[model samples]
Target: MAVRMEELRDHEAVRAVNRAAFGGGHGETVAELVAALRRDDPGALSLVAEEDGEVVGHIMFSRTLLDAPRELVPVQTLSPLGILPQWQGRGLGTALIRAGLDEMGERGVPLVFLEGDPRYYSRSGFEPAAGLGFRKPSLRIPDAAFQVFRLPAYETWMTGTLVYSDTFWRYDCVGLR
Candidate 1:
């Protein structure tokens, strides 16, 4: 499988992947969130995994603010990582994240945040954010699910509450609730 940046032609395929990965019809929220992020935040980094010309997985990282007491800092937030059901057991989701993180590090992003299952995300170097002195935007998000990955550019003073963009709140996708 080849991982590459998302393009205009990958939108529909990306949604399909999200729906398949996050079923329960709850996937609709994630699908719509990705669209809104793309529309509202053009700089959001999005990537896709393709195999045999088929889009198998998708991931997106959007800007978030760290309301630190020392100084406000800009960071990235990963969300709605989705892989086609058939590709779920494979490493597509993790690959997309590693690729995205690599790109974020290249761009000098200091931190990345996400609310996801620790069992899976831990493999990608994510740790409990609260333990690292960070706070989640919503109490609905479980402490265990609220995670952060510090890149090479990260600084000790960057710990604080993650302020998501309006699109996240508009889509009602900020937390597990």
Candidate 2:
């Protein structure tokens, strides 16, 4: 099957993919965030994986700000990468991740942050943010689960408590921790 990056249409179909992928909790809100980001910040990267006119997977990157020692710095956030259960082992998630990173890299996005499985995200070059002076704003989150990927090199410039957009807070991403 071919994987391509394109603007996501068919809101209901995207929602269905999310519902099926996450069993009503995660997917539904992730789908909604995708639409909301598109409406509010159309430039935010929203990509979908389609095969035979059906969306099998989705990944979202949105604007996020880092609270640096001096001031708030803008960065892209990679989150909520969801793939339908049936497509779990097919490497669609990896492809979407690569596409997202490549797109961000080309744009010179300084950093990308995510909260996910260390074992899996490590393969994509993510490391614990705290190790590089970045700390999670929420003391509740374990330091290990919060990770960052700096394009050129990890440095003090990227250190800060990550501030995600409001849409992410609307959903319960407990599974992320």
Candidate 3:
């Protein structure tokens, strides 16, 4: 499997993957949020996992801010990582995340935040954000699920409550209260 940055033409396919990956009742909402993020955030990154020309997974990272007492810190948030049902256990999701993080790192992004299983994300260097004085932007997200990965350029003193893009709240997606 090859992981690459999503192109303009891959929007519909990416939406389909997100919808299917989160199928029960949250599919459309998640897909809609992805679309909104793409449209609204110029710094947002969308990536797709390709296997022999078929898109098997998708992930996104959008610009966010950390509301520190003194200043706003720029960061990114990883959300809605989706892998086709059949491809779930094949490491496609991991590959997509790793590739996206590498891209963000190269772009000088200082941090990446997310709400996910610590057991899984920890493998990719994520740690509980609360331990580092990072707070969730929403009360809906429990402390345990809130995690962050500080890139090489991150400063040790950077810590505060996260502030997601308005698109996140507007779409009523995972990050909202």
Residues 84-133, model 1: lDDT tens digits:
88888888988999999999999999999999999999999999999999
Error of 1 at 41 (Å): 0.7
State the number of backbone clashes in model 2.
0
Error of 2 at 49 (Å): 1.4
Task: State the C-alpha lDDT per candidate.
Answer: 0.92, 0.76, 0.89
Candidate 2 Cα misplacement greater than 4 A, ranges: 8-10, 153-155, 172-177
Off by over 4 Å in 3: 175-177
Q: Which stretches of candidate 1 lie over 4 Å from their true place?
A: none
Model 3 has a clash total of 0
Model 3 deviation from the true structure expressed as Cα RMSD, one decimal place: 1.3
Ordering by TM-score: 1, 3, 2
- How much is 172 displaced in model 3, in angstroms? 1.5
Question: At residue 69, what lDDT does model 1 achieve?
Answer: 94
121-144: candidate 2 lDDT, tens digit per residue: 898888898888786756656778
Q: Model 2 — which ten-residue stretch has the worst lDDT?
A: 168-177
lDDT, model 2 = 0.76
Cα deviation of 98, candidate 3, in Å: 0.7
